[model samples]
Structure formats: C-alpha cells, structure tokens
Target: VPRDIASRQAKNMCDEGRGVGPAIKERDPNGNERMMRRGVYLDFSEAIGRLGRDAVSARYGNLFEMYQRITGDDPYEVPMRIYPAVHYTMGGLWVDYDLESNVPGLYIAGEANFSDHGANRLGASALMQGLADGYFVLPDTMNDYLADMLRLGKVDPNAPEIAEAKRSVEERVARLMALRGSRSVDDFHMALGRIMWEYCGMERRDAGLRDAIKQIRALKEEFWRDARITGQADELNQALEKAGRLLDFFELAELMCIDALHRRESCGGHFRAESQTPEGEALRHDDEFLYVAAWEWGGENRPPILHKEDLVYKDIELKQRSYK
Candidate 1:
C-alpha cells in the first residue's frame, strides 16, 4: 500500500483501540503519550525466519542496527513499533518556469519550490529534481537574472528598507526578551503541535479547522505574553533562537489551518473529511480548485488576500488514479 493509505489505516487502527504494543507512555515530541495510543507494530520475525537470518542481515543490517540503537529492541527477535509522523511536505512557495518566485530578484530551487510535483510526490523524484535544479537549471536561469543585476549596479546595505528590516527583527527579539511570564518555549510549542496534529493532521474538517484557528490565536497570545527566554539575545542562546522560530511556527500553523479550511476539496496528501468518494477515497474538485492558492500576508489588523494562479494543462489529459 501507499504511504498515505497505510498511514491512515494505522491511525484508524489506533483510533479504534486495536493498536498493539507494551502500552508505554513517554512524553516528548509525539505529544502527551498518556493520552495518545501507541503505534502499530512492524514485525520482521516472519521475514527473518523465511529468508534466514543471514539473508535478512545482508539486506537490512544497518537499518536494524539504527532501529535497535533508538528503540533498544532487536527487530530480529521482536516487532518494531511505528507511527505516522510528518516527513515530506509536497507543497511550498510557488515559482514560475525559471524557478523565480513572484518576488522578482529571489529564486528558489529544490524542495523549496512547489513547481515540480503536482500533489503527491513520487518516491525518489525529489533527489532527481534537486540534482537537476542545482547542476543544470539554476546555472542557466540565474545568468539571465544576474545580467540584469549588473545593469542595476551595486545595492547599498545602508538603505532605509534594509535598516527598517533590521529594526523589525531587533524589536521582535526585544519583545521576546521582555516577557515576564513563566512558560518555556517548548511548553507552548508542544501544545501547538498537539493542536495541529489533532485537528489538521491526516484528516481535516470545517468545524475542526475553525476550532483550531481559535485555539491557535489563544495560544499565540499566551506565547507572546508569557513565553520566557533564558539568555541574552546578543550572545549564543539556543532558547532565544527557538523562541523566534516558535513565533514563526505559530503564524505558519494558523495560516495552514486557514488554507486547509478554505480549500474544501481532498487533493493529494490533504484529505478533507467532507470531500471523499463513496468508497472512502479522496474526492477532488478539479473544477473548483484547479488553481494554486497564493496567499499574500496582510499587515497587522488586516485579512490575508488570496491570489489564484490557474493551472492550464496542455500536453496531457487528466484522469482519476487507481492503485487497484
């Protein structure tokens, strides 16, 4: 089965209380382990027995060693516990044919640009794209851009816009350091992750997305007002860096929920519960949502504006994909 189908199945198994394991509860990145179900087992005992231990070792010895080091379980003897977690994200900043974003001078390549894969990315394709982008595409396209830059001449570092941008960053750091509240950055981050995982991961719904947005706003307020930073901003401070990243994460997470809510159709990895086929397959509304949603960030106290770039297919025909 595909990773998406398998992941959903695993989630369903756990949700139905049919997941098997030691029922261990450990708290870390996976959220409150006590409240969440343990993962499904990836047993290899049968495989080892069938193929012989020697053959299995030859094929997967290094991977088994890594797994044993992490989980402290010998996969040769026992089943390994596994769960669905975020790995590869299919979409990113929109880019044109030359790999230039809407932002004129800025160019994106590799996984950062959402120009290659349509929705669900095929396995091992990203590596090829990444290679092509670095070794071939950028070398050719960037020359044209750089030639234009030569005509424009050198840019002054002391420009007003640059100073304002620097000031904005400094002010954000100052605000974070000024917080007198007690909660750590990790505390708020874990809470935010839990909310997103529950409401926006794997499956989504209209009501749940709305609720998530509300919860995220409340969390953001609490985070800004209360999240504590342990060290000075000028010196080496991991906590301070984390706090800054978390602030961005809060904004991005809220935006993600909003995007998911508005899209309304199930496409690729984004599976909306309200949009599905009679057989529980993803139901895509190509007519209504056949465009890239490019969101413009509105300033404080303003709503984000949606810019649609319609996808026009010319060379090939569109058809529903079947794995059966």
Candidate 2:
C-alpha cells in the first residue's frame, strides 16, 4: 500500500516537474537517473515539499535508481504509475462515538470501527487516532459501560441467545466443511480480487461498476457452491480461517464500490470518473456531500441503508487541493 501511494505521488510530482522545469530529474554517472516524485509521503505532502530542494533531489535520486534497477525504467523523467491496492478497511462495522456497535454487547475499535477519519484519511493521523482510542478513549468509555453493566448485575453467558449463536456458528462451520466442493478456497479468493481490482479499483464508471457488481454476485454464488475446504472443524484450519476472511472481504468489496459510486464527486481516495473540477482537482461538493456515509447490512445482493453524518468544517475551509 505504501509503495502504491508512493508511486502515485511520484507520478504527480513528475507532472509538477513538467510544469516547473527539468529540475525534477537528475542523473548519476552510471546512467542511473532519479527524479523527485510527488504525492503524499508519510501522509504529508507539504512537509515533503519543505524537505529542501537538494534533499528532495538526492532522496528521489536514490529511490529512482532503486526503482530503475527493479522496473528497468527511470521514474524521474516519467510518471511512476500507481493504482489502489487494498491497504486497510477504514469503513467497517458501524460504531458510536464511544466505539460501541449496534450490537449492545460488542465494542469495536482500531480499524474495525468506523469512528474517525471521515472520507479521506490523513497520514500519521491513523497512528494518533488508534493510540488515542486505545490508550485514552476506550479505557474511560469502557469503564462507564462496565459500571453500568455492574449496576444491572452480572449477565449469564449460558443464556438461550448465546447458546443459539454458538450452535449457529458451529453448524455453519460444519456445513462448510461438509460441502466437499471441487475448487479450492484460494481459487475463489483470487477470482474475487480480480473482479474487485478490475471494476472497483482506483477508477470507476457506472457501466463498469454495474458489470462488476453482477460479476461479484456471481462469484459469491460460486464461492458458496463450489469452494472446497480440506480440514476438520474441530482443529485449527488456516485454510478455513482464510476462506472466512476472504468471503468477508468479497462482501466488503461490493460495499466499497457501491459507496464509491454513490459518492459522485472525486474526493481523496474515493475518485469518480464523472466528477472533477476544471483544474483537475478533486471537486468536493461540501455544501451537499460533506457527510460521513455509514452503510447498514441489508442481506446478500441487496442495497444497504445509507446513513449520513454531517461534517462541519470550522478551521479548514473547503478548497480545491493543489500539490503545486
């Protein structure tokens, strides 16, 4: 994911170099050329720019040499190409400000909860956010929840609901193992990845997305029907575990694409081909679309509920982002 972002930034910097001059590209005696690529590095573009021109030049020169040896190309003179690779899921199980999910007993934090970092995330902020939540927010908030639970007395784990849930999980796993299908789990996972990368990748169009949606649905059907597992339910089966996670990823991929499609304007990572400003900057419809979109699960192949949390920007005025 870092490499992908770096490449994209490099490409953008190359573009900037084009506008400014040839100072973006420099060469050593070994014919190994290097160029200062631009994009968000360590999630801070301005800081990277402020690193001093000579420093930037030297750093990128070495990087470009490494990239040339690996890819057999001088990225300094040309754009370093990049496309989105699944890094981390910023959107996931919805949670409240206290990081409590709709399921009363469940509390989600870290990358699992869609707590902070609305729409586009900032670099270095993720670490800060995670630390803040884990070290500070969670401890205080969980104390309150625990206190409330204490007031209500101890809850029994042997309740019918808990037993039923366990039974359902066991049965589901047993059923999956019993299927004895012909295709391996990895086969379906790779197929899902291909479908996701093709349609719901960095760029998106309506027709392509619709086609991708159909393909993903078909793939999901194939996964349930034809996927083969090779281990018992009683033991640790890495294959089975991976299969479950991949299945979840497949479902989540659809939501991501749908969310990206619904968001008409190009902002941060969620870029839509149909929307862009005249200057090629991400055209944010702040007045109409500055809201965090939270999607609720609506079963398989059905559209999810669209919940919006309005964003009120006070310090930073919504402006077209410029790297130049």
Candidate 3:
C-alpha cells in the first residue's frame, strides 16, 4: 500500500479514537517522533503462533527484537502497536533534469533535490535515485559545470557578493544572539513543530491550514522577538546551529502551509482534507490545480510569490492515481 493512503487511514483512525493507544506517549531519537507506545495494535500473534516464533523471526527478526525491546512484549502473544511517522522528506530543493538548481554553480542531488519522487516516495526508489545521482548523473553533470568555472580562477573571498552574503549571515546571527529573551531555542522549536504537525501534517483541512498559516506567521514574528540563542556565532555551538536551522524551518513551514491551503485537491503527500472522495480516496483536479508551484520567498515579512509551471503531458495519459 502507498504510505500516503496508509498514513491518512492511521491518522483518521486515531482522530476517531479507534486508534489502539493514547497519543504520543513517547518519542524517538529525532525528538519529533511521536509514539503511542501502544499505537494501532496489530493482532499478529496468530501469525506468530501459526508460523512459529523461529519462522517469524527468520523474516522479521530485527523488527521483532526491536518491538520486544521497545514495549517489553513478546510478538508471539501480544498485538504489535504501530504508528505512522515521517520517514522521508519526499520533496527537497527544486532541481532541473541535470540535478542543478536555478542558481549557477549550485547543484542538488539524492533526497536533497525534489526529483524522482514528487511528493510521496516509495521503498528503495530513494536509495536507487541517490546512488544514480552519486555514481552516474551528478558526477558527469557537475564536472561539466566545474570545467567552465575552472577559468574564474579562485575568486576573492572579499568580493562584494561574498562580503554581502557573509554580512547578511553575521547580521542575522548577531540579531539572534542579542535577542536573549525569556524562552529557550527548544521552546520555540517545539511550539513550531507542534503547530506544523497538528495542522500541516499528513492530512490537512482548509480551516486547519488557514489557521496554521496564521499561527506560523505569528510564531515567526514572536520567534524574532522572544527567541533566546545562547553563546557566540564564531564558536561551534550546537544550540546556535539548532536555533538557526529552526529559524529557517519557521519560514519553510509557513510556505508549506500556504501551499497546502491553496491546493484544493489531495495528491500524494499533500492531502487536503477538503478535497477527497466519499470513500476517503484522494481527489485530483487536473484542470485547475495540475501545475508545479515554484514559490519565491519575498523577503522576511512579505508574502511569497508563486510561479506555476503548467503541466502538459503529450504522450502520457493524465489520469488520477487509484490507491484503493
């Protein structure tokens, strides 16, 4: 089954209180991971009993062992609880056919660039694409670009463009450090994460998305004012690093919400709750909504401008994907 459909089902089940356990009783190493230690309990005990523990272990030994360790329950007898979580960032930096971005000399590949997988990624494809880019595609493509740049001959670090970029980063870091407010970096991050997860997660509704956009914008503003980043910018500070990244996440999450809010149809990972069939299947609006949304970040306080690359399939027939 496609994960988008499965995740939606899991979320919908949990929404209806049909979910086996309590919500987010625990978390994983990533910190964002939410576990209902008893998520949706899978009654695989019968399978274990029928197949024999040894037989089951032969195929899923690692999972069985990990599950046992986590819940302290034997898979042979108890139902194994599971929760759907983000394991992949399906889309990343936008890249062309050569895995190069709009910016000259800047190329992205693997899971970093938004390619192969438009929104929902399948198993092994991510690894396959990463390998293809690393071993074949990027090596050849990037070398071609670098061959031209060989003549630029070690540009001065003190050049105006370089100086401006450095100054911009310095100003932002100094601003963050100088804020020294009451709240910790984790505090703002957690708040932002919660808002994103709740409203702009696996499933999204129009109202929820609208509210999320508002909340995110407000959070971004409050973050600038109330965020407390400890230590100096010149040194290696993990907190500072986290704070800076989280600060970027704030902008990205807001844009994500805005994108989700406008897209009236459900497709891949961008499941708009407002647009779905009665059977809970994803709906697509090929006529109006079928286009690539390239969002241009219009500064810190300004609204983003969206440019659409209208999709026109000449040979391939455009059809709604059935995930039934």
Instruction: Give the clashing pairs for model 3.
Output: none
Poorest stretch of ten by lDDT in candidate 2: 36-45
Model 2 clash tally? 3
Give lDDT tens digits, candidate 2, residues 1-324: 334334444444544653222344533212246674333222224534578546756767677577678767556445544322455445557788888888885888766666675333455666666777899888988888888788887667998989999998888788678757898988777777766655666556787787777777777787788888898778999878887787788778788878877887877766566776554555677767888888888986677889998878889877776656
Instruction: Report the error of model 2 at residue 248, Å.
Output: 1.4
Task: Answer with 2 or 3, whichever has the higher lDDT.
Answer: 3
After best superposition, candidate 1 residue 238: deviation in angstroms? Answer: 1.8
Question: Considering lDDT, which of the candidate structures 1 and 2 is the better prediction for this target?
Answer: 1
The model with the greatest lDDT is: 1
Clashing pairs in model 2, backbone N/Cα/C closer than 3 A? 9-38, 9-39, 10-37
User: What overall lDDT, based on C-alpha atoms, would model 3 receive against the true structure?
Assistant: 0.78
Q: Give per-residue CA lDDT, model 3, range 178-210, as digits (tens).
A: 877788889878788778777888888998888
Q: What lDDT does each candidate get? A: 0.82, 0.68, 0.78
- Candidate numbers sorted by TM-score from highest down: 3, 1, 2
Per-residue error for 19 in candidate 3, Å, reads 5.3
TM-score of each: 0.84, 0.74, 0.85
